[model samples]
Target: MERFTSGAHEFLIPMVFYSLFCLVLTVNVAGAVSIQDDCHERRCNNHEPPVRFPFRLQDQQPPHCGYPHPGFQLSCSENKQTLLKLPRSMKLLVKRIDYDARWINLYDPSRCLWRQLLDLNLSTFPFVDEIEPAASYTLLNCSSQDEALYKGNRVDCLSTSASQIIAFRSDGYAYLDNLLNCSMIGNISAPISPYFFRFRLKWNKPDCGDCEAQGKGCRLKTNSTEDQTECFYIPKHRISVRERLMIAGIVLGSLILAMIFIAVGWRYYSEKKKKEGLLKIEMFLEDYRAFKPSRYSFADVKRITNHFKDKLGQGGYGTVFKGRLSTDILVAVKVLNNFKGNGEEFINEVGSMGRIHHVNVARLVGFCADGYDRALVYEYLPNESLEKFIFAARGKDRSLSWERLHDIALGVAKGIEYLHQGCEQRILHFDIKPHNILLDHNFTPKISDFGLAKLCSKDQSSISMTTARGTMGYIAPEVLSRNFGNVSYKSDVYSFGMLLLEMVGGRKNIDDTVENTSQVYFPEWAYNCLDKGEELGIRIEDEEQTETAKKLTIVGLWCIQWYPVDRPSMKDVVQMLEGDLHVLTMPPNPFASTDPTKMGATIPRKPVNRELPTIPEIE
Candidate 1:
């Protein structure tokens, strides 16, 4: 019973949401109808109900306003009285038109209504008397002397005509005393009234209120029938019971068909989303349909990493743990931090690195996206990273030789170039520094850490970004200022230049531990040294290393130019690396310092933090 109740509770949640949606829709529809029919509540004058759409007041509405039925129409008189006009030179002073009841009380302007009684056969009108429905009063037009032949109780003398022809009413009774001189004109709409000048009328019009209740617009038909006596909602060519049934069936069938489609679509969407949300994702089973990766469970990841025993490194995104595969092959398992505002890094790695295969780039072996536990698997790099070598302690034997650093730079450049052009989609690695460059057993550099990578079309030259990305020293001038240029592949080039200078300097761009702020901003100091044809303060071992360092410095300066357009492409940088030192000239002052002589000038260390426009996050 508890299980059944729980299952029922789960089902009721969706039902509740759906019911709320439908209720909102229904309320909106009702509100719209109320707004339209609200005019029915409006009075032409303070004392009367408003002239409704089907019966618009002449001056108040357009020509198309009101019903088409001749008898159903009403007009305001010169004296501000509402009047209902009828045929045969007659008009009824409208006392009140009960729109709800579909009943009308009428008054005759002239009290000589009894005289016109014989002439007033209202069979052609759309109304019959509500007081005595279909009741008729028989009248006789005879001389006053002949009135004595009639019984006193059955007859009432109306009035004596100008021609001395007396009119009298023969109430619903067998008055056999009537002479052959009386002509039976027609049936009266109702019984004889004591007042004789006023009566009530019930419209034989179609039920407009009921039609509106069924969500239909109402109008009048000039051509009348039993069902559509005068007014109707879309008057049919033939208003038969069979026709009505067929129409009703068609509407009902269409509604049912629409409901079926909605149900099917909702079910399909729900099932698709459910499959995506499951721990064992069936979605990625097709993510690389032909080239599927080895799937791993959360337990498998934890076991392979030995419960994160051999930690490789940790960053803003996650911690990397060294793991050994079944084939005794080493792998780097980046176990993403679950608490970090939804695991976007996992998606970035899988979405970006999953698609490409290149010699210079890191390979994504597999992934583990088990609900809360998410991790990325990559080919392990044994030599740690270039950062350890770039910023090695003084007299450390571990520093990379200039020849090796140049090759590493070339490899890194190639990786970035491949990311920009070789892939099906252009991948912009927003965060690129020595720390992100991993070296394999062969000392071949492979670019890693795609946490801040963004994919765009290869045809697109530039990308728009909301917030600043990458380390402060390595970020491009264009990235910091739109005035410099648009953030593009050139931005990456600029970062690479900064990395190159840092590699040569053998320290970070901003060394906060240093006392002097001028020497702290390394880019400016490097520029000043290169400008004066002075030897860069690096302990060069040989001429080849010296030549390689000089060529790299010139290229780095060229790449770090303030404008994105001024920077060389990664391919160009690679070509410059392979080219001779004599072929390259000293690039212009990229820092745009007012005085190159002022070596004491301090460079700004902070990246300009600009506010980005609002955008929705893509799951």
Candidate 2:
């Protein structure tokens, strides 16, 4: 019996050895299969919410070893002492993991309570299955009025200190009230198992009907219940692979097309700007070439003008210096003051006068257009402007005879009429006061200073303006109001009328004070004297002087009707000065008194006949 038992033990030992060998082989095979199935191209578990491709773990190690998305890649830290390797920016702490639910409860220390997580794109990672739809919370001191909207559904808050259960469907994570007031919420704390809650998941197919009813397609279930299964309502409008590729191709093509358009537009704009600049330069050169005024360097100008020794007159634009170009040729050199680097007035005067050649208009001999220095050279006139003679209170030596005054008036009228009708473009002399009308040695009037002159085509009766551009009292009423007709050649007529009045008054038309008498406008005072058959206080003592002054005053009054249409043209103005006085009547007072002090003195004057004169046709 002992020999038989020994032999059986020997047989049992061989059987045990063979069974152990088979078991080792089976374990090896299982391990190899797990490695082949789970191991990805690279290891990538340590990213943020989304993990990238080419990184995974062996099947035996667990699916959580990789990220949830394809592009979020992770690399092993050089210091391999840490348990879970992660990026420097990821503020995450894994509190618990449920094996049955295949879910992890994590706390993000960087989370914001009211902020939404949808802005973060989580699809790049692979290991992170999904992000939870709702944030976890606990009801503490929250009042009943406090409500939370979760997954498009509003949930009311219960009483304070009540235990609350908030479950997130996307990651199948459940949160519980450990201590209502002391619960970890938002980015407050990193939770451990003692305060953490986990979920228990069951294998359940997603109910796609609810998603379909809500116009959405079914996604993988993250959380499931006994009766109702969990699902993500994905939109049905997802692009197909081919459509996605086509879209990408279209986007690239569109970008190329946009680039082409941009390039074309830029080239066109650049060329256009270049052409405009070149055109401006050419025009400036052409207009300014012939009359280049001997390129007087600052020193030459100083020498020619004798360092401004012989000043002819002082005016708003600048001072005029009488300089001698040669012993035989004397010139009037006007040196303009700087107007904040705006040489527009200087350019306009030079440009306009250079293009014009008329007996009545002053000729532009030459000009300078240096950086800050501007000068205009003209043939010197022996006599000064009409204002120095006619309007001076004490300068009787310079006073003109009635015949000379008439000739001067006729010459000035012809000049203005020429400006209106003769040139290719009509020139409106905005500053038409006596100061601008100069007299030569023969007492012939020549209109000077085209600085404020505006050039317009003959057919254009009116011009639009942004601002009032003329002497204050001389500006037409129509220029100030839109209710009046378009500002036309009529505007110049109005200025001429004012000028005629000033010529007759031998003083400014608007001046109210005279010696010691109460304030009185020259026009009103003259009209009163004429209507009452009183003397005009003529400085000259002759019957002819009396007749000339009366005729001049009447003609002046006839010209200065308030409305531009009521005033006479320059043609009629000359005729009235030359024609007999008996045919003329008192013109209607256009500028009737507006001041209360003069209201009682106001008297209406009758209008003159409109179509009475036939002066020479303007050529």
Candidate 3:
């Protein structure tokens, strides 16, 4: 019994000390909380500074909460804005209040603080501007056209439409003596800041500076005492050494525990994600073994591209870099921006480019899928994209001759043709804009950027699409709306048509900056010129160039027919490009019948199966 009692005493002594320590801490916290709760800080809104002792909300706080003065009392406006109304009812928003600094920041709620300053009387207010000293400014009404008037010193708000109100500094009156048609209105004495955006004011009475300096808060000695303020130690503001040690120990212990939990969770999650990524990569590699394009690691890609030092271009999907494979071979590396985007873009580019081997279609050299990083490598064309050449400023070095442009158009058509028919499964190049058309050193155009490509069987005429794809101007009407027709290979024809028109016009199809308003929509305007037998408005040096422009314009109009079924197939387009310009007739004015009711009137009631025309194939 004695031994048991001794053991109980040993345990009870420590328990008693712990209970006392907890009690003391609780009391200290409760005391601090109670002091704050007695005259709690109030705010008009979340953005405004808290109003407390030395400054209090008029209706919200009691009379004993703040200094006994009109300036110390702030009010919440109807709009929930903290407002400090001056002597003349000029309300200024209370932006911030620093009890320690003994300063209050204010700005005119009306935006023009200078207008208020012109007639401000600060004698009644408890605050005075220590930063901005009082100065005299002469107001002058000057003529609007007076060149001698200092325009920078003019008050735009006070001036009329016909005249400028110049607030000339009194000390600099020598420069304003020669002003034309200027009359001095009056002189006003006011505190002026450099830029009257914010007004800062300091106070002397109910001084809490000493208490704040000593790390204590000041309160009235008694509720009735207006003149006397006594310093009181705020436990939260000035914590004891014992409390600091206790808080530090608790924080340190919590942090160590949290760190251990986080480390374990992160390790488990990382291993799981790593395993899943490896499995995905293995499956991707397995599917591409037969195609056998080189697979590069992220490190290898960085090495090949010189740490992404030389950038070629950027698009919505990724940034392309100029890279070298060897001494002689150069490649363009496209580092995808969102490699985790359902893995659609990366899959589309690789899968679509993997099967094809065409002279006009850009060749994929390799790809990278190391960890989170993904990139596609392609053969680098020295001339960049067709956009640089066609859409460039006039007289630049990248401008191509009409003949070269015609050839490029033909090459692009062939590339699209191969995408529609040449492959085992027809590939649809959804995005076929000038930016996607890359040109080699010899100016041969190649279709690139198949990020939006879709695959369907050769026999399938139309495919189901839930959402619209491709650049805005180049997207087919059918793709945007089913009323035009079902989307199919014909959509590519429409995009190619838009591309063709852009190439011919040396501008986009929907150019708004053209001098003639009628010519703003280039395709519509080009058709009007073609229909009227007028020379295309573009600069044409010779008859041959005019004929080339007409041919491309006519083909573009035909391809962009509102109804997909009304548009020609890629094969027909290829033949049309290779054939004589005179043989091609203007397509049934596609833009003429825009109304839903008149659509069938101009368009064919049914898609007529036109006999395919043959032309000599390009070698």
Candidate 4:
């Protein structure tokens, strides 16, 4: 009976164990089939946002669920939290995605800190391999002092303390911490919310391989980086089944939600951008309306200037073309070089001339400010510039008659005086030279090119200048010397004196040559000639010529005194030019006679024992 009981127990035990193993196998198969079926045909519920490509829940899993790319993976953290792991160092907490807009809103962990997230080499994640050129991320709390460095070069920080959106053409995912120092003290205690430091990411093509290989990341979304296909490298590791399944489900769910959000956000952003563009156009139009410039289209300008066929002259800014606008109406059109980036000059000339009505100043008839092209149209004067007449060979013989010279001098003086007192503000002709003075049909002198003109107040006698303005030889000594008080309107007077000296001598004031061992400055030469009983060589065919030359020389000496106080004002200069010659005095030598042989000569020519009089301050 005992043997029979033992036999039954062994048989029953074996059958029971086998039955339990089969039940467990059946359950496992059913579970795998259910999960696979759910993923294959399940339609995402509208109530819970739809999941897009590159993302899928583990419950409805497919082989290419999270991403087809090897390094891309999405996972659910504690409490079904979604996290996206990119190729490099980028790890984004998935929020919502918009399939239509092809964008995802992500929580930036470094947003609460003083530094930037991208600046911290956040582009290292492998999952961000699909960011687009139009894709941009908004930076928060950026300031003027805060500059962005992409790779090794610094990039312009668009805003300070405002969310800055940057767009790129290709994928920027890559690890850069190995190449750059991205270490920062993070504010881990900062508040976290649904929208805590969220930034949008659009799909972009990868372009910077070297940078990615070198482990450097892009700072901005634009083409600021040298290459765009670069991505950061991340170490691979095995993940557990539970962790992988949970993460995949969360990532898929989050990706679906992100697509919906991105679509709505993109539509709003596009509309806002359109409105901003319109506003900018409106503002530009309003600013342009203040000065009513005769507008000329490109075709009209080409026609007026005979297809820019006739060249007048080329300058630092552009080339001037002579054109016939109408019957008996000729114009000089200056076609500015596109590379000469001086829009302020255009604005200054237009604004100053539009408000001023001076006979001695050139008139602006029209202008063109087309894309990459600028042109200025002025009434063409038959007579060229004053330099052509003054610096000619045997200038006195071919010179303007004494009557015309006198009239031109007076006109120039009047123009200068008007700039000093006629207008509400005092205008200083910083660059007063023969080249800037134009001539009319009647040989009348008219001031042109106010590019270097400085408008100051009458009460403010002096203005601060970092560097000397005007032609080198014509620049006043006071402008270069800090000991000579501050520069004022008298500085222009000094320049004018140099110009007058050139006019009288028919040559430059200072000419250095190996033959002329003795420095023959025109002012000093004239002074010495007058001091010595030599033929003033006053080459004058007519009595008018002799008188005009003598008068101009004497007046030129008086204007170019050593000190500003000694020099006469433009008003006094005009009066002196119009007055009789007998009233003019033999002015003192401007540059004290310095023997080149003397070593370290600092003292002026006077009594060795007596002290020179102190120079007065400029008014």
Q: Whole-model Cα lDDT per candidate?
A: 0.70, 0.57, 0.79, 0.60
**CA shift of 154, model 2, Å:** 85
- Per-residue lDDT over 1-619 for candidate 4, one digit per residue giving the tens place of the 0 to 100 score: 3564476466557555655655565565445434322223222343333443345544455644334443234555455556665433445566776544445666756453213334433333332423222233323222223235332222233322443322221234233343233322222111112123565665432333344446543112334343223233433335559656755654564565457457645765776799899997987676457434586767788999999999977766578889987988888888877444556656665566555446787667777767667777877877867888877864456576666767777788888888888877778887788887888787778887665677777777777777776778777666777465467888888888878877777667765532453434556766667667443554468766777877888888888775676789999999999898878887877656544322112233432221223332222
lDDT of 3 by residue, 122-146 (tens): 5456777877666667778888787
Off by over 4 Å in 1: 1-292, 338-349, 512-518, 594-619
State, as a TM-score between 0 and 1, how close model 2 is to the true structure.
Answer: 0.47
**Candidate 1 lDDT, tens digit per residue, 584-603?**
98887766453434432333
Q: In candidate 4, what residue range of length 10 has the lowest lDDT sum? A: 185-194
- Give all TM-scores, in the order shown: 0.49, 0.47, 0.49, 0.47
Q: List residue ranges in candidate 3 displaced over 4 A.
A: 1-292, 340-349, 593-619
**Candidate 4 C-alpha error for residue 333, in Å:** 2.4
* TM-score of decoy 4: 0.47
Model 1 steric clash pairs: 42-50, 43-49, 43-50, 54-66
On the 0 to 100 scale, the lDDT of residue 217 in model 4 is: 33
Cα-based RMSD of the predictions, in order?
26.3, 31.6, 23.9, 35.5
